[model samples]
Target: MSESGSSNWAIEATDLYRRYGTLEVLKGVSIRLQRGKMVAIVGKSGSGKSTLLHILGTLDTPDTGTVSVCDVPILNLSSTALSSLRSKHLGFVFQFHHLLPEFTALENIAMPSLITGKSKREAFNRANDILGYLQLSDRASHKPNQLSGGEQQRVAIGRALMNEPDIILADEPSGNLDTETSIQVHQLLRRITTEMGKSLIIVTHNNDLAALSDEIYEMKDGMLFRSEG
Candidate 1:
């Protein structure tokens, strides 16, 4: 599908393949994630789980096949267009919180909108709104170091949501958290899918975390298959 057409799925990949010189990473992995669903992918290191995530997020390109996000075929878009699409329609979270150390949580969360040329007032308003939803309104003025690990991660999630993206791509979002914190994050992700109606694809190693998703896949030798059956 392209920008002019409609798609039932939020993200779709067809016969995806990737390689780093002689080492093939993805071997025709294809996946379809419906709107408002959460998907979790798990696999050993070097099994191409992150690679697939990068491609789907449009941070990297695949050697073959096509990927569509929000029904927009992005494989051939110009870098500027791709960047614009990503800013408007996608959000990403990594294992690390990646919040700016010097900025207050509000400023860090407001960054994406500011980068997109939104007014400071507008950006902060949206940031404040999401911070409330994330239960971090009280932490808005705290710096990254001032927040606890779980709080920081929630701020990062708040930042990802500041732009009101349709899809969230998370790579090991709760990897560094304690078990209780990890469970909280997992519940938050699932709540986001149901309540906010945003789709999410998370790459994680925790089977219990994966169990919370609407669908689960595990990468093995660069191929992705359903883990449920």
Candidate 2:
């Protein structure tokens, strides 16, 4: 869409359109996300930022146009194939830390690997590695209700990263946290992108977090515009 070379892109969407009955949410939106870079999408409510995220994350399909990840078109994949692809390549975080209430933090983080057919032992090992990276090793046995808000969010991020996904999609990852916690979460996200070389695409309304990204784009009226350096 921007005349960018396709080789550099981890996710690409072209002429994407979406509709909810009489309301058209996305109108010819296109984006090119480069590998190992963090891009932030910001907009007011009802601007279609979340819709774009769902499409890119393979959770939903566009009504028209194409969406691809690492040059693989996902729009037409079988449900099983899409599920496998999402499990192996894409990670997602939401505003709410959706950890299973009955599971410990470690178990929660290990769920993705388990769902992907890894042995329980193997999954827990990988989960341990990510929890340690996020400085949550001490809280491994704690359930979601037993951990602090920041710790729970960290666990959620750990779960998303458990499978070594190529891209991470976060929608208002710190929306429920206080200002200080949100700042810490933002820094953690930046560190992950920089140190792990993981591509991150985040949809958020917080300017501070957006400013920390490698690129920032604004969504308005179903269109995107470059917002800042």
Candidate 3:
């Protein structure tokens, strides 16, 4: 399957395992996510959900496993190749907004494009388009500190979308927001998959929010189990 490109899967993983010292975090976990769908992973704080997400996002390596993103095998790629692949195909959102303090929301959103050598005019043009899409056109000139928590997260989401990634992996994306704001973020995430046709996998603890996903999984004892109704 590693060499096959005909499959419609956005991400496919098999026999994923990871460890730290004597502790095993992931135990032979595997998953396949389709395009334009959303999957939610729910687990306790110490569970391996975040570790699995990091591995899937190529931010961390597994002790043993194979991962293919957009049908490209990832395990054996060189660091430079991996970084390039990650930047081109994957987007990430974390609990904290992680926006740069000095840059305006527009600049932060344009940073990824700039790093990839896009001209400022091209980058900012796309950034403005994204700001409009995110309904934050007025906040583009505001810095992270000036925006509300939800707005800051929306800026981070805009930054993620700037690269036009195939899949989005979010780790507690709404973890720090109030209930209403979290609900808005959750709805926006759902929209990303449904309206924008991007695959989404989110690691979150909120069961109510998890219920909104197309698929749900639970992590426990370093193992992943599909949740059933």
Candidate 4:
């Protein structure tokens, strides 16, 4: 484990770099995410903020850097191993809900646990618990199309929690919602982090959400700048 980050830190990225063709995207980006804390990254479009989030979530890799999740170095892990590690230790929420159109909210939320080899009963039990916590118990049986936008997003969040991941990586999670709903989601995410002892890394353009985070960073010119506000 790196001395700079404690054992409880959910994510640690050191000097991360990435390039595409001739375009250099990330430039020596480093970040730390402690469990039960929230961090936000903001930047204009094409500023590489989303790229950094993807690397942190392990959906993409850095060309030169080290990324650790739960103290496990991930660079050399096989695809299968990385899949298993992600299922067990990380969660992701994006702007779109990405739910199966045919599945009920409960079933959708239960999918991750089921994929990780949990029994159907165990998966539903965990899913139901998260739904209740998110105050979506009444909509459990409803399909995605039957729910409102906010409800759909909440179901997506429940799915992310299915395997009890230690860290959540969100990319504009509230961007599609109205202002009131976005604020509600922002507060809800903070409460969830505190209550579940999970860390959050969100890439957003919304200043309101950024303002609510414990630490905020702005990405510009392929570098990170910590924000005082």
Candidates in order, TM-scores: namely 0.96, 0.95, 0.96, 0.95
Model 1 lDDT tens row, 1-229? 1234567788999999999999999999999988889999999989998899999999999999899989889977999999999988899988999999999999999999998788999999989998899999899999999999999999888889888889999999999999999999989889988898899999998999899998999999879989882
The number of clashing residue pairs in each candidate reads 0, 0, 0, 0
Please estimate how well model 4 matches the true structure, expressed as its whole-model Cα lDDT: 0.89
Error of 4 at 138 (Å): 0.8
lDDT of 4 by residue, 71-177 (tens): 88999999999988898888999999899999999999999877767799988988999999999999999999999998999999999988888888989999899
lDDT string for model 2 (88-176, tens) is 78999999998999999999999988876779998988899999999999999999999989999999999999988889999999999
* Ranking 1 against 2 by lDDT, winner: 1
**In candidate 1, residue 201 scores what lDDT?**
98
Residue 174 of model 4, lDDT score: 91
Distance from true position, residue 136, model 4, in Å? 0.6
Which lDDT values do the candidates have, in the order given?
A: 0.91, 0.90, 0.92, 0.89
- Candidate 1 has what TM-score? 0.96
In terms of lDDT, the poorest run of 10 residues in model 4 is 1-10
Top lDDT model = 3
Scored by lDDT, model 3 comes in at 0.92
Ranking by lDDT: 3, 1, 2, 4
lDDT of 1: 0.91
Error of 3 at 10 (Å): 0.7
